[model samples]
Each structure stands twice: as structure tokens, then as C-alpha cells.
Target: MEPLNIQANQLILLRLPSQNIKVVKVEPGSIISLGKFGSFRADDIIGDPFGFTYEIDSGMKLSLVDNTIEFDEDDQMGAEQAMTGHKITATGMQQLTSEEIEALKSQGVSGAEIIAKVMEGHAAFEHKTEYSKEKYLKRKKQKFLQQFTPYAIGSTELIDIYLDKDPTRIYNLSPETLALALNMGNIRPGGNYLVVDETPGVLVAAILERIGGEGTITLVHENEHPNLDCLKYLVLSEEERERMIKTINWLELFHPEESEPVRTKTAEELEDLKPSHRRQYYRAKQREENHKEILKRADTCGFDALMVMTLLDLPTLIPQLLRFVGGSRPIVLYSEFKEVLVETTLALQKENRVLAPTIMETRVRKYQTLPGRIHPLMTSRGYGGYLLSALRVHPNRAVNAVGKIS
Candidate 1:
């Protein structure tokens, strides 16, 4: 595999000091104006590697910084200093007027120099405790720093961005639950998967990343056209996109029909046809062939795994989807509400088509991990969502097992 580089026309994630992220297209010779922070020519960072931090200033130059750090430990120390103290006086602490701050910004001073000047003018700088002092400096840096990190956007980073922007867009799915579903389904390269993704396309993109160009994802969507908007951000070549992803409607998958026969032509006949007619003839033939293959796969019932992330009623959805998955293959379902999955699990249990249906949820608690002030953060997202997973199996009546009826 080639090492992924920041290429022109590809989407890259820019993470700001304020912990806000922006998805930007890397177009060469274009100016990327980050508003107040600063602006830089896209050419400066076009060929650079992903996951590097760059500081932009009025000089229109880019300075690279190595950002590899242990995030948990660093986050804890930073949080402890910021939140483990009494609220400081919002007014009268800093003597620099708004005009002075704007002048400094316009002058294109380095982030450190600006922060130092702000601290020097702060009337209560000497009175603050050591931890409080660190907190103030950090806050000032976040506000005035003209710095942004360009990270290689992957599933987890994309999820964080969506969660912050609009939870409803991705059904409030979390990285933890997404990981669980992938593991439970045993998703890997070269496997064929049946997916119903109403999370728009995050789930489909994640699967594509794991499977690469080898595996196939037959995505089932409710409407006539599939909603895979998230795939627009992926930096995939045309060949990879065509080789890995395929889409089908729910009605087509469930009630497939033989496609109309397309007219055929000999090599001589095709050469003699008009250019436009030849192109149309080839397209029709390809569509008919693809439809036949999809219908065959649907009828064969041998998908490697079945993964679904949708808001539709699961109890009614799962049973219908399970029929397309082969025996002993994993079936994983994700929902924002546990109640939704619980109902599906009960139905699967009653039908005896799945083995040991289980509902599981994973939550991550962040903390301020200083030696003396370590504790959970005061505010965090309350839910990370839930997963209902089970394996499709064949029920044998020839020999009685402990849980089987004779």
C-alpha cells in the first residue's frame, strides 16, 4: 500500500486549538482563510504528510510542529489545571484593551509572543496559583494561536466531527460502538458484507477502510437512491471506489426481478454504430449484467456478515435481513436507544435463528489526571449508543443438543 499523502482535491481535517474541526479541500494555489486565526496558501501544505500541525500567520508562511503526544496523560493534566480551581474574575484580570489585542493580531506576532504579552498585562497574574496560572496561559493560547493540525481523516475522526456538528446526522453513533460492531462482525479484507446503513454513509465508509479494495459491501437503502453522502470526503481513487462499494434498494434486494434483455451487437456491428449509440448500448449491457449478479447474490444467502445501523424498527428489520446472511455468520445491529435493540434481541431469541443475542454498550469517561486533582470531567456526552450482536446458525433436529428441542 502507498503511504497516504495530502493530495490536492482531497479532503483533510483541520483541527484548531479550540478543539473545533473543519473539513477542507486541499486545492493547490488557493488561499485557505481560517478567518481570525490566519490564512495561508494551500500550496504551502499541499505535499506535506498528513497528521502534522501547521501554524499560519499574516506572513503567509507555514511552520510545522511535531504533535505526537500521549493524549490521555496530556489531556488529564491540561483539564486538571483548567477546571480544578475557582472561577477567576472575568474582568480586570487582563489590562490589554480589545484594540491592543487586535493590533497585536494584525501585526502577525507569534502565538507564544502574543500570549506572553497578554500575561504581562494581566493584573492578577502574580496572584494566581501555579495551576491557575497554567490554566490562564492555556486558555489564552487557544484563543490567540493561529495554529491548525491536519489529520488524515478516518472513521473515528469523522465520527467526532459529526458528533460535534450534528448528532442526528449520524444517529449519535460513537467510535466505541462502531469498533464493537466491526469486531463482532469480523469485518476484514476480501469478505462480502450485507449492510443497511441509515447513518447516511459513515458505517459504509468504515467498512470500506477495513476491507480496502478486496471486499465487497452490498449496501441496502430504503429509498430508490442510496444516501452515501459521507463517501464524498474519502480520498479514494475512481478504481477503488468502483471495485469496493455497491448499492441496492431494499425493494430490489427483497423482490428482485430479471432485468430486460439488452440488445447485443457483433464487433463489426458495434464499430459501425454511431458513437453515442455505442456508448448507450454498452451502458445498458453493463447495467443488466450487474443487476443479474446482485439478484443472484441476494438469492444465494451466503453473505459473510450482516451489519445494520438505522433508525427503522429493528424487530421488523433484523429478521428480514438475517435471511440473507449465511449460517454461523455474525449479525450486528447498532441503535442510539437500547430499547430499540432490546426488542430485536427478544425477537431473535424467540425465533431461535440466532445464538446468544446480547445487547452491549461502551462508554468512555474522560478525566483530569493530575496527581492531586484527578477526577471525571464535569461535563461529557451522556450516551455512546448500544450494540446488539449475535451469530446466525442452523438449527438441527437430527441430533438433540442441550438447548435444542427434539
Candidate 2:
């Protein structure tokens, strides 16, 4: 793993107290705002390791928070309170007004102090059940806490940030589904892969992590150019991208020269171009040659695996890519709806082109794991969609069993 310190100009995820995540580019001397929560100088956090949590002081200064810190009010509340009935009072549930809270802010009150003040003002706070009081305090802290945690960017972080911002963009795919897809696809280092990723690039990003930038990925895209926008979130350089990633559109893959009109220039013609134009010419020629080489290899040797995550009609796509997938290889498709994959699965079965076509769904529900307080967490992600997977095979061949007809 790379050193986990915050780097200058690196993209990082800042998770705020309100459970809202912000994608920020850390530039020295600049300040990133968390709306009403607070803002901190980017330089203040530079060089810190990944797991430190920072609390913003009134002067915008940052101080490290203890990892084992607990709320004062919460620590005082006992489980016995959970069984106690409410004691009704004329002051009602809460008496703090917005104007008063703003005045407290102007007085430079910290978030914990503000929470304590609110608890004190609530006439029925102690009378309420422990769980109810805990919820109320937590909601207030989420709103008022001037703290944030910075997370290093990775496949899981990108998926979470993207899912939180726009689930539809990533086919509502979850981490569990990505894991399952990768396991089923058998992605590994130094393996050739054919993929069609329309989650713009989330699926491609996942594959790269598993492959470890050691193999080529022939990403067949729908548009004129592949949407390699994943580079925005990933830490790939131009050289690494050129080495491990190959992109081809439908036209470029199937009708190579017809779409590009590759014109060969003689040595004499190359000498006629200016220095800058000559450099550009050679780069374009190299790209063309590389594309041809990848296509030829896929055609002759076939890819080790095939994975796709797109809304395109699968019936049309499977035939084009399956031919390039070697026998006994895996083909995996991800769809937000099971209905979309049903048609694709049946067609593959009818053609006898694959074995054991299966549709899988992985749902994860987390719980509070503290021994006595164990139960499901109140909020959990209900997304991950579905996967259709099968192994490519040559139906024309008959195989002999190694074991004696078990």
C-alpha cells in the first residue's frame, strides 16, 4: 500500500458530522467549507495519516480528537432509564429557540457545549427514554458538531461517494455486488479482460484494483470515445493508463480501419511534416498499431474474462463479445433490475454458449456490534442490484472426464 498520508492536490473524501460526504481536492493555503458545520484550512491537515479525526476550534484552528471519546450526556444515561416512563411537564420537550442558539454560536460555544446547553434546557429530557434522548442528542450533534474525518480514496470510497451522490449513475451497485462480480469474474493480476462499463467508470475502477495494473483491459464503449473519466477519482498517471488500459468503441473494435481510415505514410512523407506535427503523427500511428494488436490478440487468443455493466440490450452485446472470450472463461453482467438480465440469461442458455447461467443478489445489513446493544443499524443501504454470470464454453467439443464418471 502507498503511504497513507494526505498529499497535496490529492482527491480525498471528507465525511462531515451530518453523515454528508464532500469530495475535496486538498490544496495548500485554501479552506474547504462544510456549510454551517465549519471550515478548516487545507494546510492544517497536510501530511497527517488517514485515521485522525479533527475538531475545528472557534478560531478555525484544528485539534486532534481522541478516538475513544464519548459524549458526556450519553455516558451518564443508564439502561434503567430506557424502561422509565416520561414525566410530563409544562416546559414540554424542548425550549431552546433558534435565536438563542445563534447567540450561543456568536459567543463561540463549542458543539459539545451547545449540545449540553440544549439538553439542560429540555424539561423532559431525563424523563424521556434513554434511546429517545440518545437519538435527540445525536441529531443535534450531527447538525452542530464542527468535526470531520478525511478518508483516503479507494474503490470502496469511490463507490460510496458516487452511490451517495447519484445511485442511478452506478446502476445502484453496492460494494457487495462489486465483490461478488470480481470473485465470479476471477479477476487477477496479469490477465487479459474484455469489459463494457457504462457506470461511466466505476466498474472499470473495480477491475483495475483486482488486476493490479498488470494486464490490459479492452474497454468497449458505446460512444465515439471511451469514458475513462474514472481517472478523476483514481490515482493513475498517463504512463500507467497507457500501459494497462485499452479503450475501443464499437466502431473501432469491429470496423477498425474503416472507422479510423489508417493511412500509412512513407519515410519520405514523414520527413515532409514539421517537428510538432511529426511528433503528433508518430503518436497517432502508435495508438493505431496498439489498437490493432489488442484486437488481433483478442480475436486469436481470446480474453481471460468478460465483464459488463451497462443498460444496453444484453442480447445484442453478448454475441459480439462472447466470441472473444475463451472457453471455460467467465462472463459477468451487472444490472440494476433482474428483469433486464432475464432475457440475456435465456438467450445464452438457448445458444448453449455458456454453462450454469446464474443470477445473484447480495444484500448487506449491518448491526450495532457492541455486545449488549447488538441489533440492526437503523439505516442501511438497500441497493446492490443483481448480477447474471455464466462460464463461456465451446458447445462443439466433447470432453472426457478426468475422474471415473463420478
Candidate 3:
């Protein structure tokens, strides 16, 4: 596993103080903005090791620093027990005026120094307990810190990036739901998979990561063009997509005979064309050959599993898609609404070709359970939705072999 470095003109995830992630391209000699968090020059981070926190200095230059903050628990906490931050804010909170803070910023003071200055103004600083002080310090850092971390875009961060940016874009498909679909589908490296992605490309991206570019993912889409636009953020190279991902629209998958590209000239006649003309001619011919191979793969040996994450009519779509899957293969479907997956399971149950069908919904929460200080994590929230699972099989009549004892 090679470490991915920060490169110019490539997308990287920028995590700011607000806990929001911005997918930014590091263009050389250009300014990268983080909205209210201010902007920084791209050159400051280019060619550096990725996933390291880069603190903004004087609003332009950046310095590498560890993002972790230590919260040393006091051994004698009983002697200093005090009320939380909310119980006492009468006159012990902030004393410095907003104008003074702006003045400090104009002087080009560092964020940590500015935070120290603000803490000096808090009259209740020494009276609070260790936990309360830690909470106050964290809030001050989030409010005044000009630090940001640039992370390499990969499968591990795509879920957090999308959920923070726009959950609705991916149909609210949480990390747990994505994992369930992959495991239930029996996805693995070097295995062939059939996918119908309507969560845009999040589901497809997850499959690509699990397969690790070892096998094929035949993506069946509903539009004239495949909507795997999210692959760019997961796997950066176009060549990787061309090699590992094969796409066929619904029309092409259902009726390959009618969707074939027509040839304008024979190979021998094409040879007489100029070099520039020959380049385009050969590219189209090769693409056509690849399309034929993909169709053949679907009609012959078949795929190992079939996975679906779509907003279309699954009750009608999934049954027809199951034909491309081999016998004993698993089929997993994801949907935010339980009723939709329940409807899909009911429709699959009626088709005797499927085995015991099941539908399930799940959720998760992050917690920090320390003695005398048990609570959910700061950013704790519930996630995940619903899934419908079943297995594909071939119908056969029972028979016994006739034999005579010797």
C-alpha cells in the first residue's frame, strides 16, 4: 500500500473547524477557499504528505501540526468537581469585545496565541472542572482556529465526505447500510458483480474498493449514459475506470442485439485513412469490441452476485436483473424507506426462483463511555436505513437415480 501524496490539480478532502469536508482541487498558483474559514495558497500543500493537518499561518502560509488535542483526566477529580459550562455563564464567559478580537486578527497573531489571550479574559477559567475546561478550550479552538487538514480521497473517507456535504444526494445511505449491502452481496476481490446504482455512485464506489481493482463490476444503469460520476472521487484515474468498471444501460443489457454500434467502414477500407482519422476509427472499434465482450459475459458464465441501490421501481426491475446472476448467488437491495425494500422482498418472494427473502433496518451511534463521564461522542448521531436480502437460484424438479443391487 503506497501512501498517496498531495498532488496538484487533484481532488482532496479538506476538513475545516466546523467539521465540514470540502472536496477541493489543488490547482498550482491558485487560491483554495474554505468559505468562512478563509483561503490559502495551493502551493503551500502541494507535494507534501497527505492526511496531515496544515495550520493556516497569517491566513496564507501553512505549518504542519498534529490535529490531536490532549485531555488529561485529573486523578483527584473529586476535589475539583464543578458544574458544567451551561450552568454558569453569567459574567465568567467572554470579556474581550468583538472589536478587540478583530484587532488581534489584523495584527496577524497565531490562532493558539489568540485562544490563550481569550482564555485570559475568562474570569471563570480556574473555577471549572477539568472536563469543563476541556470543553471550553475545544469550543474556542473551533471558533478561532485557522487550521485545516488535507486528506487523500479514497473509499474510507467518501462516506463522511458525502454525508457532511449532502446526505440527500446519496439517498441517505449510511456507512452501516453500505457495509450491509456489500457483505450481504458477498462482494470480494476478483469476483464479478452486477450493480444497479441509483444512490448515484456511492454504492458502486464501495464495491470498487472491496474488489480492489481485481475483478469486474458490470454496472447496469437506467439512463442513456451511466451515472457513475462518483468513481472519479473514489478511484482517480480514467484508465482504472476503463479497466475495472464496465457499464451498460438498461436498454443495452435487456436487448443487446438492438443496441450495437453500427460500423461506417470495413477494416481494410479504414486503413486508407490518414493517421488522425485512423486514431478515431481504431478507438471506436476497440470500444465496440469491449461492449461485445461485456454483453457476452452477462449472457454466459454470469456474475457472482447482484447488488442494487436504486430509487426506481425495484419490484419490477430486480426480478429481470436476476437472470444475469449465477445460481446460488446472493442479491442485496438498499433503500432508505423500509416500505420500499419490504415491497421488493414481497415481490421477490412470489418468484419461486429466490430463496428465503428477508428485510432489515439498522442504525448506529458513537459513544465515549468512561467511568463517571459516560456520554455520546461530540458528533454522535444515528445513521443507516434498510436492506432487503435474498439468494438467486435455478428451479429444478426432484429426481432419483434408479439402481439395482448386484
TM-score of each: 0.82, 0.84, 0.80
lDDT of each: 0.78, 0.80, 0.75
Instruction: Please provide, for model 2 over 1-406, each residue's C-alpha lDDT reduced to its tens digit, 9 standing for 90 to 100.
Output: 1238998888998888777888999999999888887888999998999898888877788987764243454444455753342333334446779888888877777777787777778887757765785588668878777888999877788788879888888889999999999999999999889989987688788888888869888888898778766557777787877787788778787777676545888999889999998988887787787788777876787898899998889977787778889889999999988987898888886776788899999998876433234457777777688999999987653333343232
In candidate 2 the C-alpha lDDT for residue 291 amounts to 81
Best by TM-score: 2
Q: 1-406 in candidate 1: lDDT tens per residue?
A: 2236788877788888777888888888898888767788888887787767887766888887544231222233454564654343334555888788879877877675666577667868768875786577657867887888887777887798789889888888989899989999999999999898987699998998889678888888898778888777777777787667777777667666543467689999999999999988996676566666766765686789999998889998888877788889999999999999889988887777788899999887787554344567657787778999999987775543556553
Worst 10 residues of 3 by lDDT: 67-76
Roughly what TM-score does model 1 have, to 2 decimal places?
0.82
In model 2, the runs with Cα more than 4 Å from the true position are 1-3, 68-110, 113-117, 120-123, 126-135, 368-374, 379-382, 399-406
The count of residue-pair clashes in candidate 1 stands at: 0
| C-alpha RMSD by candidate, in order | 4.8, 4.4, 5.6
Q: In candidate 1, where is summed lDDT lowest over 10 consecutive residues?
A: 68-77
Q: In model 1, state the lDDT of residue 4.
A: 67
Q: Rank the candidates by TM-score, best first.
A: 2, 1, 3
Name the better of 2 and 3 by TM-score: 2
Model 1 misplaced stretches (Cα beyond 4 Å)? 1-3, 66-109, 120-139, 258-284, 298-301, 368-374, 399-406
Model 2 backbone overlap count? 0
